[model samples]
Target: MARGCLLAGARLVDPAAGRDGAFDVRIAGDRVAEVAPSLDPAGAGVVDCRGLVLAPGFVDLHTHLREPGREDEETVESGSRAAALGGYTAVCAMANSEPVADSGAVVEQVWTLGRAAGLVDVFPVGAITVGLAGRALAELGEMAGSAARVGFFSDDGRCLQDSGLMRRALEYARVFDAIVANHAEDSALAEGWQMNEGEVSSVLGLAGLPAEAEEVIVARDLALARLTGARLHVPHVSTAGTVELIRVAKRRGVRVTAEATPHHLTLTEEAARGYDPVFKVAPPLRAREDVEALRAGLADGTIDCVATDHAPHAPEEKDREWDAAPCGMLGLETALAVLLTELVPGHLALARLVEAMSAAPARARALADHGGPVAAGRPANLVVFDPEALWTVDAAGLASRSRNTPFGGRELRGKVVHTIHDGRFTVRDGRVADGKG
Candidate 1:
């Protein structure tokens, strides 16, 4: 796609530079050319961002793009479109794809398809263990050398239970400067679980996935990180105890960081009281106290980022009974709105939100061209959002291949109006733009 010009008029928020202002931003050749109170509208395409808030495009640290297999659920093309529509310029596509991205060949294939999609920068996260079985480590070094430049590895939806194997994986990954991300669930304790192990699950007669299931794994991972002096990241940590554990570990200088999902930050397991599969997710949502603690942690800078955990499922897959249904919810489009309406209103600043959504995730994933200060030399990945714009989420209207969003019919306060990836408007006027290339 050829690049030209764009003047995004709204509150420009760039967390990396600590900048916030109502400025007109100009783009030229896939990089931010100038940002000021006013730019010469000389022959440039003018975009009326009257009520929008322009910021660096979001970067999701965790996303499940079920491709290479399970294309019926989601493919790189469809998932990339979903990311673009959700205001993400980049997303770390989980390695649990079809055929499992456990080798260099598979990883490179995913990377190529993602680029061809031309909607988002999809970084392929390599599996921590081959087949994500938690028994043997995958070819981390080889995958890291592939086109994807894999830096993050995870066994998401499965726990790395063997301490020796995990230690070895971490030790080996460090050689290539890769970080190991754990799903943080003790399979032994969480066996037969469906929702959060609490009063809600008990009341609903659903098998409870205990909080200790997460806490124990978190505590163990921190110890391993401390021992190996290797970088570790915990994904979608849902319990308050896990938050305090990470806080203390960071205090003690353990090389550990953690992320919380939007659902965990806002909705509790109580939202699953009706056995709605939309709320079903791995590391199921927890109690209200946990939600408050997660909010406090994000506000206080203990939690490193807020990831979507954007797991997509076909309608038939999620339409089953609670126990028979698959875990996960569509998150890309609803994440920002949930953050704006639920977090910002309670003292979380817009800058903090940007950090959690973009800057931090970029740093965590080690992506060179994303997250942003929006300078003259950086890649022009940006999003124009109408922060005050109110709209109802109609799952039927989303760009993802699936309509499993938990926010269906809910009125959200913020909406993404335009998303530019590599200087091309992948999403314009709140709709997915056809591929420019």
Candidate 2:
């Protein structure tokens, strides 16, 4: 094998280091050996990165790999491939699987599967509730000490409704400095809801999920986080009210962080107008004003990062009537394109976008080796992309096993040209590398 690789002549955009200029980065082993204005290729394999932006690889704090049970929808290998293709070098796998990743064995299984994939680094999120049952706590300490070393816990598919239980969970997580991410929806208020509660839902005559449903839970969680002083993460912040709550909580010194999804930032409840099941999601799409608030929150630092909820389902499960279909849509492959096409330059600066998608998320998840500043001695976890490249989304061309992307058939800009993880090219020339070269 080549001793190292040389990425030549790329505009390095490392938000963590506040760098945005032309530079050549040399990789030796799995670390960046050098970074300069120019470097000779020597014996290293050279990739011409002219006209591309080389930045730290993206990180997703909320991705559903659906392994150990729902392999028909997605597996660690397939999901890692999709993440690499989308410029991500690391992703936090959600605990909501068929058997539920509530124990050390399960989380380790997921972690091992990710390593075997040899694409992105996968960190398994342990379940906060046993079997996501909401009644009892899972093996948080065990999972944390396990081989996966899970530092994030959540019952993403279901909210832990018992206030006492949630407080106890927060207190327990504080001992390990782990993050407890909540889905932030009250089952009572969002019960049987089909879409966001608004004019569109009123017109469509479908049951509505009110914004207050999310805001109430967030308020409660914020209070609990303040009481326990534990690290709390709110996943997929969707509503304007929730954004305001998070903003105020941060101002009050609560240990809280929030994330917004690409779909939630760009799409609104109006996408459900045609009753397309693909648009159905938990904490369902909110109003246009809510979308604006989410973007502003991300740009202004109230929202910490952008995470692709990246849920995938089988065709039979997602192609049914809106009310009958399951929530979630494919996101791993299209998150960057969607954000670049919809928010960059207009609503957010490119540096801020890079921070949200890469550095910020890695910081939130505490993945020290993933996000970067392209300095010597840093891990070679990086992505190179053409900011001006445009392409049309096609479900068949995606690496995910499901065909449930809402952006299918839509044109998007900023295609990923290459993705490197641990000094190996996982994606090259806009295609997944076979590792043979």
Per-candidate TM vs. native? 0.97, 0.98
lDDT of 2 by residue, 178-248 (tens): 99999988989977999999899999999999999999999999999999999899999999999999999
In candidate 2, stretches whose alpha carbon ends up further than 4 angstroms from where it belongs are 1-3, 435-437
Clashing pairs in 2: none
lDDT of 1 by residue, 69-136 (tens): 88888889888988888899999889888688899999999899999888999889999899998778
Q: Looking at candidate 2, what is the lDDT of residue 65?
A: 95
For this target, which candidate reaches the highest lDDT against the unseen true structure? 2
Worst 10 residues of 1 by lDDT: 1-10
lDDT of 1: 0.87
User: What C-alpha RMSD separates each model from the true structure?
Assistant: 1.6, 1.2
